[model samples]
Target: MGTRRPNALQWVWYTFGGKLPAHLSEWVLHDVTCRTWVLRHFLRALTQLAPFCVVVLLLPGPLHIRLSSIVLGLLVGLFYSASAMVETNEHRLIKHGYPPGIGRETRAIYRDLRRTARDEARRRRGWE
Candidate 1:
């Protein structure tokens, strides 16, 4: 829905800006491949918008937080959530490589990471 293929520089910027490491580029790539950009946007928007809505609804004062704030919050939250989700999913994928049950996958990925740093190291060395 937005841009595609965020470079490493972009990732660094996002990370520095407090993102949890969700790679929008990779999510976009996967979504585009699956022809699910609309769904991806919708979900990401909903996730991001949820918090803003809560803030707006729960505001103790009159609903005068500025339309700009609301809109900006929505946009920023969406991007942040999308990025976070991408990062979390990538971590899972790196650890588990796609299997059933997220809990199982998460544990597997964690266990693998603990035991397989050498493998990753070897791969990195090969590229050097």
Candidate 2:
């Protein structure tokens, strides 16, 4: 398997903390280390919360009450998601046979390179 993508079922499993097949390891690494990983994390968190939110919405309630419930649920859910983001991604990578911290390490290297390039450009323009 040349870095196969997860099927919808596998993706749902993954979104709920399950592991993908070994051949999907490359995809997992990209997911955890991508430039949009934070957004991906937030989206995953939201997806995890969607079912409960739907239940809450479906229950008989005033518009304001339902809206407030959704808001509070999302805020708390996203707060926890953001707080554990780094560790979660690291764990995901580890579960997929990546060395511990590799995701963070890779992102850090990319970030450093981008910063270096930006600084070089700034210096070239006499802006710093």
Candidate 3:
């Protein structure tokens, strides 16, 4: 049988960040594959946040004046958190052929991991 691929968390770290929490990584591996876990979580977060955003936007002037900064800050934090999580997951998905984007550093990481995976596969197949 073919050797198992590196887990999603490994791919995530190799592609973007340094490392992930062991529990979190295991969850990412077990529940998420091919980036579906992250995309699903992202959509879920958006669905939850959208109503709060709409309410904040549609609030009356008095309420807006009283709560605008607070609401905005909270929403901003939520968006940041949501985007980071999505990005972490996206990095994991790079193994499936997603482009790394236009940055030099990111492109280098993507290239390294892709090369490593390719080399390993070739080695296993006795094509090296």
lDDT of 2 at 39: 92
Residue range 1-128, candidate 3, lDDT tens digits: 12344465664444343444444443434333432545655554555466566776676677657377657756785678576764555554453344554223443565688899999998999964
Candidate 1 steric clashes: 3
Models 1 onward score TM values of 0.35, 0.86, 0.31
Q: Between prediction 2 and prediction 3, which has the larger TM-score?
A: 2
Clashing pairs in 2: none
**Number of colliding residue pairs in each model:** 3, 0, 0
lDDT of each: 0.53, 0.90, 0.53
Ranking by lDDT: 2, 3, 1
Q: How much is the lDDT of residue 118 in candidate 1?
A: 75
Off by over 4 Å in 2: 1-3, 120-128
Q: Candidate 3, 92: how far from true, in Å?
A: 20
C-alpha lDDT of residue 117 in model 3: 96
Q: What would you estimate as the lDDT of candidate 3?
A: 0.53
- State the lDDT at 15 in candidate 1: 34
